[model samples]
Target: MIVENSKVILSVKNLTAEVEGVQILKGVNLEVKAGEVHAIMGPNGSGKSTFSKVLAGHPDYAVTGGEVIFKGQNLLELPPEERSRAGVFLAFQYPLEIPGVTNSDFLRLAYNTLQKQKGLAELDLLDFDDYVQDKLKVVEMNPSFLSRSVNEGFSGGEKKRNEILQMAILEPKLAILDETDSGLDIDALRIVSNGVNQLSTAENCTVLITHYQRLLDYIVPDFIHVMESGKIVLTGGKELALELESRGYDWITEEVKV
Candidate 1:
């Protein structure tokens, strides 16, 4: 469903950021258009995660320079909550477990918050339950999850599925999944990837930050970007993933040094 010449959903211009006074993202530039999926890949400290966090407005990371424009607005200007309401979704690598909040309540609150942003009526409990049931199917999650605490006592895969459920309900214009494939078994990976694929559409953009190419096997990206020392040193078509898998990142890093 990728439309050629679609509107740009995210634009990062010479972005530089740091955490705890140490630089992470340096001179990073990327552009994502509607309907396109992009994957960011590199070694452990390549700043792939930092880029995603900075996009989500993580306070820990300070933007020392550059700008991020989302949907034609200065992305860095909006607070975190406002970013979420503006249809920016970030599925964390490690989703936190809330001990007291029930899944149903948390999901409803999030959905209603977005509804309020749009000046739409919020769905009540019964109506919301019906609405959520449909969204749960996207992740093939069970209704029993609603009764449990948000991500509490859930398996790793279940936690990831829960994140996807949130994405299904919110239907954000831009979805940034940071290392979502981490700590997942084959079955879990397949299920989660399928859920992500189901949620993708012609009007939304997906950015996946991953290490292994296996994840890309399931959720093929239109472009694959390689980050080295806080910069996107290389970008290519889906075939780049296979090359990286076969040759490892040494070639890419070495080429970057040239």
Candidate 2:
């Protein structure tokens, strides 16, 4: 269980954002402490995915107002690459395919880039091969995956597993998995959720952006929040997820208005 006294790792205050002149996030405020797992759930168009992208410094989204502070530094001030190097990882819902780049090469490049940024020793090909092999076990992946092009011909589950594999190798402080449960089968979901649960620690945090409560069963969150109209309308504990799953989100939205 996460303690309340843990230091805040992420602070968002009245964060408003837009994409292509359309406002998506309206004054979103959230605080994430070390060791905490936060689940953001809502219906379609509630801006759950947008919040994840904005945190990662996506180029298309414009920050119209407010600020984000991560690890005592201005997060919005950092570029996307800097954000990743600074230990902020965003796992996209639809993992992209890089047909030309080998998976091992891609992971090694990313890991080495972060290592260099932190003044740590860079791993050579031989060293990285040994290192990544251990991480592949986190997702039950085979060595053959390392030789294949990045997500080139991978199935949906394979792609998600590859994303988690990257997260394991990078070891980010705050990992935001945006709808990772999407398009996954029971077996795939279990593998992905187990990987996530194993990776979460007292020193790191995870933010899960999802619509279904089923994912929460495997990787339970310390806090569950409901998003509506681009804002976090309600926050609660794990039981809230069960409530949302049973009764739907209308009751919460209606209560908020009253």
What is the lDDT of every predicted structure here? 0.95, 0.95
* Model 2 lDDT tens row, 134-231: 99899999999999999999999999999999999999999999999999999999999999999999999999999999999999999999999899
lDDT of 1 by residue, 1-258 (tens): 468889999999999999999999889999999999999999999999999999999999999999999999999999999999999999999999999999999999999999999999999999999999999888889999999999999999999999999999999999999999999999989999999999999899999999999999999999999999999999999999999999999988888889
TM-score versus the correct structure, for each prediction: 0.99, 0.98
Candidate achieving the largest lDDT:
1
- Deviation in Å, model 2, residue 74 alpha carbon: 0.4
Alpha-carbon runs more than 4 Å astray in model 1: none
By summed lDDT, which 10 consecutive residues of candidate 1 come out lowest? 1-10
Q: Give the clashing residue pairs of candidate 2, or none.
A: none
